[model samples]
Target: MTSTLTRLPRPYQSYVYAYPHKTAYRPLAPRPTLHEVWAGEPRDPLSLYLHIPFCEIRCGFCNLFTRVGAPGDLTTRYLDALTRQAETVRACLGTEHSPRFANAAFGGGTPTFLEAGELIRLCDIAERVMGADLDAIGFSVETSPATATTDRLAVLAGRGATRISLGVQSFDENESRAAVRPQRRADVETALARIRDTAVDVLNIDLIYGIDGQTPASWRYSLDAALAWQPEEIYLYPLYVRPLTGLSRRDRAAADLAWDEQRLRLYREGRDHLLTQGYEQQSMRMFRRIDAPAPGPDDYSCQTDGMIGLGCGARSYTRNLHYSFDYAVSAQEVRAIIDSYTATTDFDRAVVGRAIDADEARRRHLLQSILQADGLPVADYRARFGTEPHTDFPVELARLAERGWLADTGPARLRLSPEGLAYSDAIGPEFFSTAVRAAMAEYELR
Candidate 1:
């Protein structure tokens, strides 16, 4: 069946109504037990994702599971549980297997927003559970530009953080004020200079292209400032106005907001500019130094099967199952994440049935696989699944090819064209849509 969406911007119009946004959800196909896949198995590599949900303040555009002024004692309570959770995660490893860690990311409303003591304690928990060979691990932490302080950077280095992804949405004063993100350009530069001199191996700046009261000029300026810092990595994201947030509050009247055409153009410019500066396009949003290279495709998060999540709203994908816990929110929001994660089960099956569905698994592979520095290996897929992408996704691949959105450069190699990368969210329907995925898709497109 041939169909197209009729919006405008020609390419977008073709995707206007091709298919209903929602795709059928296929529950996870049966897989081996967690013990078998992760315990002592020689499966995929491993990483750790720790979530810290407290922030000194909130951003207008942020919808992450975080809160400001969450009880003064919140950090203490969270660290206690975090320690226990780390132990629980460590217990999952078989006695015979060696601890293998490729990366560890401390992400949140602002992980640096935590008190120095709490930050130190949490890092202790990581070292205790995973050990101190972190010198070999690609450890990363996220922070808002405003919160980047000398003390905070010092704490991160103490905890073995090798990279910092600072959030600097825009350089324009008006745009920063509109988004309620208060950080001067000078502050970010000073902070970066200090961080660069630290033990941290990589410096990553996160820039948002589309936002209320932001224009191409503003975005270009932000890009220029980020480039001036000469970070080892740069992540470019477009502004997304999600429902029920401060962003949605002013999204309607924001003429500076770059939607379809403008958003696309801004992204292209970022790519062109970064490429000119000797940064290779590692993925849609990420650019890295040519010689040093990134670990894999999904550098933001680990692509491996064993990711241990700590803190409220943290998500862990073990070999066979997934588990998550959130810090105490109002009775309402807690129930929401819990409900969504534990949907399939009556009481907590949704969360308990955490194994990823085949479709989602497939989609994850596509996104992360293409982004791989080593590139996707066709033989590797066949060895694992006993089938090829062409055999498994014949229809989907055919559709994408028909639209000239993708090209099969080799048996296992597929690349998204500029148009496809710009509209990459369309690839998600082939899998499931949790509230998070829906939110991510809507935000990425916006």
Candidate 2:
């Protein structure tokens, strides 16, 4: 049952993380009640996500569901709404279920964009409304080098944030400018110093390749500069210019074959460089220092556990459904959605989402697990599905193997070869069900 379709094009799509883009999600009419969504779902060891959708400035390549800067008291109003949403979610989970969050993350345009006092309140909401101890779990928060001020870093570190990921897309001034992310190298270095002064358990620096006019030498310089701090983790991302993003209006030649070839060369170069630096490749994008402290519960898996998302842009996942408030990439649409979210009182169930049937679930399980460098565990897949992954995704698996993207490394594992991992973006999309792709295609990109 191998796929008869043509292999997807190269320099390959980038699979930073996750699958089934939010565009694939449609409005759920007669949305299920939260309790109904969680019915018979395991309550222990869940993941919690708190989204702060405000940033000081929106980068050119950014298309995440976040807005640039807080308008007036919008920040205050947004936090209030988040609190209300958390309360509703917790109530729905119920006291009897005794939901224990195993891991938590604060992400957005930049969680550190909030003032020091605001950040304290954000942590309080997680503690009081959600019953998640900020200090007890593996808490990770996203920050920008410009926003990682000492006061903010102190607040995060004090609140039990184990990992702080700073988005330093590139250290080269021209590359940064080309990506429309302006900052002085001195500021980034100062922020790095301030972060280290906080003595946080893990420091993750994010770097982006494929910026317009970026070269191999420039990419190495950025990588080397990041390594100077001995960050616990590093994520190298390929820039994708999506619709409605700042970078979208750029010259058409930005995404040509020659540009892609340059990106691929830089990616491989950065990857090999990081490996030599004693960092382990967790995925194509994530590389962690060998000595970095292990974060998160080993038993918790996104496939099996539930997640609670507390902001308009945040998304919650249950066994059968993935949901969130309305999603938008355009600024006006994003503001409208945020305004609507702030005005809403009914926080009990999903509004915008796509229901996942058994087949979609299997596909998700495989797509999420197989993209990692370590690959998918056959025994675990069998234990959950009562059949081998090969049986469920025969066409997909066979095609990958035929193209040298997959290798059966052992009786208990089906892993992607390095080449296959390089093609993760292409491979991941191949597993998308026809219905999902069509739904996504039909979606209006507001």
Candidate 3:
């Protein structure tokens, strides 16, 4: 059994590590400034992402670009740099064009770690630079239970934040302690209550199963606890070990940490329980209210290269190219990365295309379609790519159908069965190239 597991395909190995921690990427050398990459469509829809890379304390499992320091005036300086980056992005994307900045997301170690006033300033700068009204934008912010206080909630509300994703990894005290993320359940409830009456219309709770002390029974209780909160969205993620993270070292040194199968079982059990509680499974890890806005059918995961990321270790993608800046290296490097943004550059289109292969795109569409209670729309796919979904990938789709993983809801529409939806993560990368597969394998080793 061990040898079989060791010899598993690269896609399977990669999928196992898809669980959450923090964003992982390398920084670009001799940081360049934002410049005009290939001009996107004149009226292309753009999303604004603000990276607030500051954390009170780093989680043992996190590999995100965040640091521990409450240096005086740090928030002010970070916001200033972010504003400059936004300005550069506005110029590069074309100022005169009213590109639809449909959504805005604030993510990081913990956005609420910054003073409320700092967050407001960042929002003000974003609105002024993007020329987009805050009321119409789909703004979301991520907060940790320890930092989200009544005051912070009020500041976020005032800034027109629409969604609040609370990092409530687990309600179990032991599990929380083991994860090195101690939070009072009451504090999280209070934060949720404060956001409930505010402009933050969506409350998404993030839960982590498959932790060191986690089991199916324990995870079941966690789900029940989460459902009691009645969050608009729930993201159930498995625990993953990353190199250099505090948790990885502990797990390695501990004589008896949880095994891989235990983690997998926890995920499977938790997912099944969530579906039973009336939440609609959206992506691989996200479950939303039945009526929430369904994510787009496009390969958004691979298309996230052009986003203008701010803060420490944030990455951006433009014209199918990827670039990142690291704040953890040094204050000078961080500032240099921000100032290096210019008006033009070469992007990795081929890499982007490879990242979101046809199989991956199809899997994303199918998973989202099922989550939305709709089947894949043949006409839309035809309209977007001038080809039918089945025509482009009949071999795989037909095989899945034969295995009862897919169902023909209509002439050109197919829906994933519950079983297929459960396997969505495993199914997405079945068509990656050998080279891509090898790269994924190497990533796993790191």
Candidate 4:
């Protein structure tokens, strides 16, 4: 049986992180209040995410929910809206059921795009408005080399930011140009120096593989350059050209079998190289230094815990629903959503999301947990759902086993083999319910 399963074809899907794309989200009529959404849910340690959807420039291959540049007063208005939303959400959570946030992150087009003063105010919203202690919990922020200046880093560091993730897509100028991410190596080095000068405990540098004209040698060059910083974490991403992105118009040939083979090879090379450098693989994209301080609370688990997302681009998740403001890729639509988000006075519960039934919840639990280096624990699954994973996903489990992807199918646990982990992208989408696929397909691409 292990020899007979059909292997997926080339351009193998890479589900690097989270699943069920926001594209699948639909409008929720008569949106429920946040109080109603959290009524019976456990007030466990929650994760907080704030989205800053403005960037100095948009990369070609980028499809994230962010716009390029902020027009006059747009940043200020957006921040005001964020504060209002936070206050509203805080009120919704109420005093008694308010959750204790164990982890927090500021991500987006670029959180550092704001001025130093704006960054300080951003921290105030999290601390004073949302009631999160930045100094007590792990606080991470995403930045671009161009925006990560000394003053900005100092502000973040002063506010108790433990980790600073810089997007240094590549060290080679030509590759950066090829990815439509213009940046000089000098800028990255300068940013790294500034970040270090702030004494931030953890520095994460992000790199990309499989860019056009990026050869094995060039990949190694970028890898070696990133390792030179001895970053607490390094993320190697395989570039994907999505619709409406700047790179989408370039060429479709870049997504073929040969390209995938090159990407796979580069991924393996980076992984093996980092392992040799004494880094541990956290996921297909993340590698953590052995001695670095843990990035998040040990007790917080995204699989089961609730998340509070603040911003037009952020998505909040409860036990059964994941909701956010409208998602868009095009410049016009993003601007419109941001304008609406800023002008609105109502910050209620979910207004756009798909309801997660029991089966979907089980699938979400499995997909989120199993993709990690440590496979899912069967006992925990059974305890949570009162049934075995095999009982709910027998066919999928059998197919994985038939493909030699199951490492162990013990009574106590169901672990994926390393080879299985490599194919995580292919496995994750297989669990998407038929309803989700239909909804996503029907959703208009904004």
TM-score, every prediction: 0.79, 0.96, 0.77, 0.96
Clashing pairs in 2: none
Residue 417 lDDT in candidate 2? 86
Give the per-residue lDDT of model 2 (tens digit) for 276-362: 999998887889999988876787897677788899988888888899888889999998998998888889888888887888888
How many clashes does each candidate structure show, in the order listed? Answer: 14, 0, 18, 0
**Runs in model 2 lying further than 4 Å from the true structure:** 1-8, 14-16, 253-255
Q: For candidate 4, what is the lDDT? A: 0.86
Model 1, span 69-174: residue lDDT tens: 5564656666666666566556655556656666778888688877777778767777777553455665788987666777878888876677888887777778
- Angstrom error of the Cα, residue 426, model 4: value is 1.3
Model 3: how far residue 9 lies from native, Å: 6.4
> What CA RMSD would you report for each candidate?
6.5, 2.9, 5.8, 2.4
Candidate 3: tens digits of C-alpha lDDT, residues 6-30 = 3332112234222111122223343
Between the candidate structures 1 and 4, which one is better when assessed by lDDT?
4
TM-score of 1: 0.79
lDDT of 3 at 195: 67
Cα lDDT, model 4, residue 91: 86
Model 4, C-alpha of 105: deviation from truth (Å): 0.5
